[model samples]
Target: MYECYLTFRSITPCQQAQRYLTGQSLRSQLLRTPKSIAFKGCGYSLKLNDTAIGLAAAKLRQANISYGSAYRIYSDGRVEELYL
Candidate 1:
């Protein structure tokens, strides 16, 4: 399975995004933004399946929720930055 990580400006937006995604029928998990990718310290993020990435982004856009960045994580542990 493919995975995607979406970063938010702060924990609040991250949590909000999680709830929004859940209500939209997408599964997500809350996790800390990886230190290497996080420009700021200790920010929260949402971990989601790749298949839901597009729909999730669209919903977040429609809801006017902003995100910092996104990344696609590979099975072998490599990560590629994603433009939503």
Candidate 2:
């Protein structure tokens, strides 16, 4: 399964990440699609549609947000970074 992990460059006081997220948080807009052979992250990973990754990245950038990277795992069990 292909997984997208998003980690902040410098996450401070880990607890801050929790306080920042509350009722109806901004992350609520993020959605995951299982039909695309993707897996949702445990905590911070934002599961997005592979085809829409670019659009999502753009929106994130416009919102002053950043993501770690994108991973593509092939049927042969080879995983690599892919462009959006």
Candidate 3:
């Protein structure tokens, strides 16, 4: 299955997003942002299944949590940047 990495500007928002997503019953993993995809500088990210991207995005929006860019990691190792 593909995975989606949702990047955040800072660790604060990243942690808030993880907590909010957990409250909404969505599964996410908090991890250091991959060097290749980290925004601006070092950061963190929420890793979840690609299937949950839409609902997760909606939930985050409803909670007023802002995030940076998102990237979809393909099974074959290709990474595509998402504009959402």
Candidate 4:
């Protein structure tokens, strides 16, 4: 499985924010695989293709998606954040 790193100032799960992650705005969806990824109560996540990580974050940020950054999370637990 491919992994991505994402940072958030807050992980407190606001209603709208949560919905956004699951919404149709992007083909990506929130990470449901608990062991694979973690999402704080009020934060947002985007699970897109590994290669699209850069473009996804960029386009999302350009669209005003609230997030600190996004990255690739390897099986070894290494995380690489890409700033949008």
- Compared with the true structure, the alpha-carbon lDDT of candidate 1 equals 0.84
Q: List the pairs of residues colliding in candidate 3.
A: none
Q: Name the runs in model 2 displaced over 4 angstroms.
A: 1-43
List residue ranges in candidate 3 displaced over 4 A: 75-77
Off-target runs (Cα >4 Å) in candidate 4 are 5-26, 32-42
lDDT of each: 0.84, 0.43, 0.86, 0.52
Q: Write the per-residue lDDT of candidate 3 for residues 1-84, one digit (tens) a residue.
A: 577999998889999999999998999999998876764898999998877877888889888899888898777777889866
As a whole number from 0 to 100, the lDDT of residue 22 in candidate 1 is 93
In order, what is each prediction's RMSD in angstroms? 1.7, 7.8, 1.6, 4.7
How many residue pairs clash in each candidate at the backbone level?
A: 0, 0, 0, 8
Using lDDT as the measure, name the better of candidate 1 and candidate 4: 1
> What lDDT score goes with residue 78 in model 2?
66
Best candidate per TM-score, number? 3
Which pairs, if any, clash in model 4? 3-73, 4-73, 5-71, 11-42, 12-42, 13-41, 13-42, 13-43
Q: How many residue pairs of model 2 clash at the backbone? A: 0
| lDDT per residue (tens digit) for residues 1-84 in model 2 | 564433333334122332333221434123232223334332244444455455655555555555555555555666666565
Over the full model, what C-alpha lDDT does candidate 2 score relative to the true structure? 0.43
Over the full model, what C-alpha lDDT does candidate 3 score relative to the true structure? 0.86
